[model samples]
Target: MKRGWWLALVTTLSSLVVSNGAAADQSITALAPFEVFADGFRDLRGIAIDASGNVFVADREAGTVTRIAPNRTRAVVASGLQHPVGLAFDFAGRLLIAEEKANRVVRVEANGGRTPIILNVTRPRWHAVHENGTVFVSTQRLTRDTDRDGDDDRDSDDESDGAEIILALTPSGQLRLFADGFKGLQGLALNHTGRCDLQDPDSERRERRHARCGRTDEPVQEARGARTRQAGGSLPHG
Candidate 1:
């Protein structure tokens, strides 16, 4: 039997309507204790909130995507996914998802349809959608099957060897290698100044890997990379 890892989120109900002035602070009610949403799910990972405040969560272990409404009702938007990890809202208000084990990014429509936006990505753990509908994603190194039994190696200690990268997905269905030379790239984000500020904890002898990713690329933080530069050095021109 395959032993499955699980992560379940306990939903908290907060008091929504508060009055004006200091009376609001004094009369505010406390939040309810966290409880399982519609019972339970497994291995939750990336989550995002839509304009209407609906929370979309990716269940990594269960291969499902769920929507949590303002009224705390739960709905399964997508199921039978490929180890989904990241969730975001595109410029057009569509849902975007990243799958680590599946090595792809997909767009989910309101009618529950899915289209592959980016493919052949190796370990795409997290992603973000820009205003122009571009997608920036962080990926890790592909695991090795040392024994050649069709399963990747399970040993995770010191796994930051040549396995960090960022990818760009254009609006017109173009995929490009945006950035590389990271050790343990994980999550991604974009700043107002539009610089690629990487969050690499495995930076052998450096603080972080801040690449000057083009407007197409963004920033992300996760695993560690080997020593590439000295502290406070200029961002690598990768």
Candidate 2:
């Protein structure tokens, strides 16, 4: 159970993605990628660093969560999770994982114990933990089949809440749809001023098309179009 992983984007605090010598600035020195711990990772997905400088890796295929210590030693903190992807340390240093196949997010303990934080999530992939303990989760596809006719032909799901949705989960366990109508939402990041942005792959030519949301009950559009106004930037406070 080796725990090494690619450590480019998760070096210290921020990650910079450069292309074709785009970052030729003298102040920016390109660093070589290094493995932190032992090798042999079956499927490494999301990576996170804790407050204590400990590195955690999520193996979606192996169904395990591994922690690489500051001294380079590795240990399995949690296991048996289903397709754990995005990982974030909460305010208290607890590891929260977005379990995609499980359709929920779970808090992993030091002794391999797990506490289900949210449920009924559809393909929850990446997530962000707000300073106030509010979790913002991005889902690929949600199935809200009202008619139960074996097909999710709901007008609401097809219109606004279609194949993608951003969900907000409160510390008190309340869940709400933050925003919707996205195609390639992958991860999430929040700036110091408390604005939400998505890590999308489909925004290549549309680079500036980041879905930024406010902390209020109103939704913020990614400047998408008319449907964006209806898909306000905030969720109703629980």
Ten-residue stretch with the least lDDT total in model 1 = 1-10
Candidate 2 stretches with Cα past 4 Å from truth are 1-38, 144-162, 205-214, 217-238
Predicted candidate 1 versus true structure: per-residue lDDT over 71-164, tens digit per residue: 9888888887777887877767888888666566677765666766665556667776655656778765434521112133343223434566
For each candidate in turn, the TM-score is 0.63, 0.66
Runs of candidate 1 with Cα error greater than 4 angstroms are 1-39, 141-161, 204-238
Query: Model 2: how far is 30 from its true place, Å?
Result: 5.9
Clashing pairs in 2: 218-233, 218-234, 219-232, 219-233, 219-234, 220-232, 220-233
For residues 111-178, could you state the per-residue lDDT of candidate 2 as single tens digits? 44566676656656777777687778777444444112212323222323345667776555456667
lDDT of each: 0.56, 0.58
